[model samples]
Target: MQKKQFKEVVVEVKHVSKHYKIFGREDTVKALNDIHLANDAELQPVRRGEFVMLRGPSGGGKTSLLNLLGTIDRATEGVIELFSSPITPESSDEYLAKLRLEKIGFVFQTFNLLATMSAYENVELPMIILGKLKPEQRKKRAIELLTLVGLQDRLDHLPSELSGGEQQRVTIARALANEPEILLLDEPTGDLDTKNTVEVMDLLLDLNLKLKTTCIMVTHNPDIECYADRILYLADGVFEKQAINIEQTRLDYDKYIEYLNAQTHGTH
Candidate 1:
């Protein structure tokens, strides 16, 4: 396995930390102590076109780090550089919102699709919000994205009509509606069955390779870590370590299912 070649920086945290002030609690909860991601000294930063996964035990601050990277929440201290733009605690909400709309895409465990919107509309909503395209352009882009996610035939299907996997695919398609530079996913496959989980990860890998869209995903499944170029382990609100794959590989659906079944049997 060759060392991963450090590329352009997409996300970097410089000694960042986060603190939460509970109303009744006298001491602020330190969600994240000092952390570092993008740096040349020993630790390497996430680069453009890289697939990075954050993994750790519960309350390990994976989501806290992710939130800071996503600009959904500002850090209590230090700076987060997104595409070389500094995100400080003082960064305005308006600026962050605009940045999120223009550059970042998010997909979550639950398919937060609008119940009334069909697949096409859901995919088109982002572009509409950004107002980056005309109605005809948005329509064309929506169809293209749905097709890209293998939902061309289900364009008109509502969220309720689609299966969990299909709804997730729609969510993925919608995330890419505006062609975001980076996609931040939180437990994207948490609600999925074994088969769907593998399928969604494969789809994500395909998109990552084909589109070169950097993926920063939070996942608990160690079995599928092969899909990432690098996996960062977070614990106690700090980066514990990281592992780099020889090369990203997709899981064979049959073999993956078999492995899961074996694990289940062994556990009992």
Candidate 2:
């Protein structure tokens, strides 16, 4: 085995746990139970420009962990360090909001593009909220992002007019509008057909490499694990195991589709 290179750590989870309270019940649903990430030598910490994937069974707290890491939800116990700054349940919402706006970006299974907004407008919205760029600057960045995502020609098209893959590309462009250091993706390809899935993952891998953005993604597809530098498996709300890839890889669309077809046919 090759000695894996390590980089500066950008995100750390220390003994983090999460649970949700039922509005009218005494019983609370435990989502994560005292999990550690990027904390041990065996489980290497997620570093700058590292692509990590969280995989586990349904209801195993994969999305919950992603949410906590993204600062969209608070951990019930322990703290998560983002860019070396600690975030606890007591962290101020205002501060977290600012951090998210300036440092973190998110893409989800649902594209979440506004129905009435064009691709350019969707991509521009984040910069508008951040308010760091002038109107013209935002316009230029929006176009650049859309072009980067291969949607330059679809800039004026509404979400409804775009295909599943195109809608996902728009979402990815929108997520990058603020030039965030970390991009959190929860099943960004979950809604796509196999062809689109291959296309979208390839695009994400390209962007991750090009922008040097740390990517933490939650995915159910094990076949695509090669895209990640490290894969963390969560089961019953704990880190079940971890796997590190010496190098990132992509799925060739034609070969992947052929393999899927073989699997389907072989089952008969």
Candidate 3:
């Protein structure tokens, strides 16, 4: 197999830490401790179009790390650079918000769709917030994205009317509304079943390959690691190890189907 070469370091983390003060208590809990991504020997700098996975136990700071990367939360200490621009604790809220809107896309585990909105409207919300696209353009793009996620017929369906997987797919479409350079997913398939999980993974892989979207996903399922370019294991708020996923390079829908069949047939 040929090794993949990536150009440009899209994300950089240096000596980062996150802490939260306990309510009515004198002690503070450290969510992350001196995590450095750019200088790590095992984990290379994140590049465009790379599918990276962060796997760890609950409360191990995987979600915390994802939040920081998405710029939804600020770190207690150290620097985070996105697109070579340093994000410091002192960065203004406006700056961070604009950065997130323009460069970053996020999909959460709960599928965070608006309860009252249809799938089309939910997907169009981001573009409306960005205030750059016209009404017609927003509608067109929302349809395109929903169609891309195989929900063309369900655009008028509300969150309550859709299944869990469909709602999650709508959330994914919403995340891509701004055509972000990096996509951050926090336990995207946590609520999905085995079949739904496979479908979502296939969609993510397609997006990564076709759109060249940089994907950083936090997951606890080791089975899903087969779709990652590199897997970083986190433990106790620190990176424990890293491995290049040779399987991801050759993975496809057919291969996954074959694996499923083999497992069903009790074959290794």
Candidate 4:
């Protein structure tokens, strides 16, 4: 693999930290401490194409770190830069909001789609809200995304009509509607059964390999973390471990899960 140039900064985090206020907001709990990140080693700098995983226990600050990186939430201290622009305390919220919409795609665990809307409608919702596409074009693009997620036949199906896996696929389709450079997903397959989990994992892996979309996902499932180019493990608000993909992340993820399960049950 050829080395990448350090000319551009896709995402940079410098000593970024978050502290959630406790009680009525007097005390604070540090969620992240002195976190620093950069794409200096990224070979294929799409200004957007990098897949990284964030893993930790519940409340270990994985979500907090993501929120800061995505600009949905601010850090209590330090700096964050997206596309090389410093996202400091002085950065305007409006600008950050626009950056998020224009450059980032988010996938949540709960499949945050309108219950009354069909899969197509849900997929088009972002474009409609952003007013980035015309009415007819939005419809066309929505269909395209549904087709990409293997939900072409379920375009008109409501959330209630789809199974858990199908609904999650719809959410993934909706996330890709904007053609975002950076994809932020929080526990995407959290509620899935083993089969559905595998299916969703495969879909994400396909997207990463085929599209090379930059993915930053937070997952508690060790089985899912293997699907990324790199995994960062957090403990007590600090990222303490790192793993890089040698072959395919899926194989590592499967083996890791099996190891974990065996350790849990003392079967190994």
Candidate 5:
């Protein structure tokens, strides 16, 4: 991978607010309220492979924040600057859409794969839609990505044929196909089993270190946050606190699962 332009500010979110207008409801819900975060606060520039975790409960603005950073959703008020470019624009929807497709990579909770297509074909769909490469080259690159995700043998398998873990892996491969500078994942392991969750998280960490891809992930799982270099806690649409630990957080994947399950069932 080519070296990224280290910015004094990779992402500068200045007093941003996002509100969703419901069609039937009288009250609009505020997803993000007066959120301010400087990517390079405290004399720290954004380096490649800088991992950040946005931690919050389900109702909080974690997903909304990720959407803002991804440039897929706009804030109702305030400025969002990415790579020194104003993402929260006053005009032009065309520009924002263009930026999202070319600059950012997204891994969603649903996996978002075409059920009819094979794993390799699903991965190449984005390149085809973007017209980024020729058919032959796209095919080759898709195979290469699948191999990287340990899905070399399952490339020709359909989504229905593959396990849920394999499907998510294909989604990950697709996300990397664009070779984006920043990867935004929302609850990537939310649907996976314990073993698969760990495997997926491990793969993401490996990619972060090896490819130097800047990663921003949102999750309630503390174990998942362990992979991050910095953790930002959110509550009631606000940044509550932040923790910076250069070392990985002590993560016992099984223990976390047990705790979560116990909470779910209220078992002793």
Candidate 6:
């Protein structure tokens, strides 16, 4: 079997550290301590179209690393670059926001959908903020993405009316609204049941394969790591190990659909 080859470095972190000072305390907490993603001898870049998983115990700075990679937060020390461009602490907020809007997508554990907005509207919100597409274009694209995530029937449903899995799917559709090159997910399956988690993971895998989108996800579930090309384990705000998943399996959409159909028929 041939090994999958990755092209172009998407993210690079070098000796990064993040620190926070506690209010009313004399001590400073080190959220991340001297994290080096790519060393000199081994340049392990997160390449385009790769699924990289960050796994660690709570308070290990996994979310913090994801936040830095997504450009949501700046590292207190060291350097981070996206697509070879350095994302320094001095980078303007406007620039970072624009970069995030244009090149990056984010999915949160909370499913962060607006309660008042219908699924379609929730998906359309990103494009509206982007202001690049016309009303018809946005609507058409929103429908396409919602359909892609198997939520076409739930287009008009509000978040409250949808199940946790359905709401998370809506969020995924919204994240893809601008067709970002990189997708950042923070514990996407944290709130989902086993079946829903599998479904969501399948959808993500399909998207990553079909769209060639680079994905960086923070996960606590070891089962989720099976789909990742590489897993970075962190502890106490530092990387402890990096493991390449030789047995990583790609979920075939056709087979997945067939399984879903069989389950539906069996239920009825």
User: Which candidate order results from sorting by TM-score in descending order?
Assistant: 1, 2, 3, 6, 4, 5
Candidate 5 off by > 4 Å: 1-8, 39-47, 249-268
Higher-ranked by TM-score: 1 or 2: 1
Q: What TM-score does prediction 2 earn?
A: 0.95
Tell me the TM-score of each prediction against the true structure: 0.96, 0.95, 0.91, 0.87, 0.87, 0.91
User: Once superposed on the true structure, which residue ranges of model 6 sit more than 4 Å away at CA?
Assistant: 1-3, 39-43, 250-268
Query: In terms of TM-score, how similar is model 3 to the real structure?
Result: 0.91
- Residue pairs with colliding backbones in model 5 are none
Q: Over the stretch 9-83, how does candidate 3's per-residue lDDT look in tens digits?
A: 899888899999999999998999988888464456788889999998899999999999988889999898899
* Top candidate when judged by TM-score against the true structure: 1
**Candidate 1 lDDT by residue in tens digits, 1-268:** 3344547888888889999999988999888998887575466888988999999999999999888889988899988999998997678889999999989999999999999999999999999999979999999999999999899999999999999999999999999988999999999999999889998999999898889899999999998899999999999898888998879998999887888888889952
Candidate 6 structure quality by residue, lDDT tens digits, 1-268: 2466797888889989999889999988998998886636253878898989999999999999999998888899999989899999789999999999999999999999999999999999999999999999999999999999998899999999999999999999999999998999999999997778888998898888789889999999886677888999989999888889875575555665676687879952
Could you give candidate 5's per-residue lDDT for residues 1-268 as a string of tens digits?
2333444556778888999999999999988998887644532433457878889888799999999888878889988888788774674787876676776789987889999999988999878877879999998999999999999999889999988899999999999887887899999988998888888888898788788788889987776777888888888898888888656544477787788899899995
Candidate 2 lDDT tens digits, 160-182? 99999999999999999999999
Q: State each model's C-alpha RMSD to the native.
A: 1.9, 2.0, 2.7, 3.6, 3.8, 5.3
How many residue pairs of model 1 clash at the backbone?
Answer: 1
Per-residue lDDT of 149 in model 4: 87
Off by over 4 Å in 2: 1-5, 39-41
The TM-score, computed over Cα atoms with residue i paired to residue i, of candidate 5 is 0.87
* lDDT (Cα, 0-100) at 123 in candidate 2: 95
Report the poorest 10 consecutive residues by lDDT, candidate 4: 38-47
lDDT of 5: 0.82
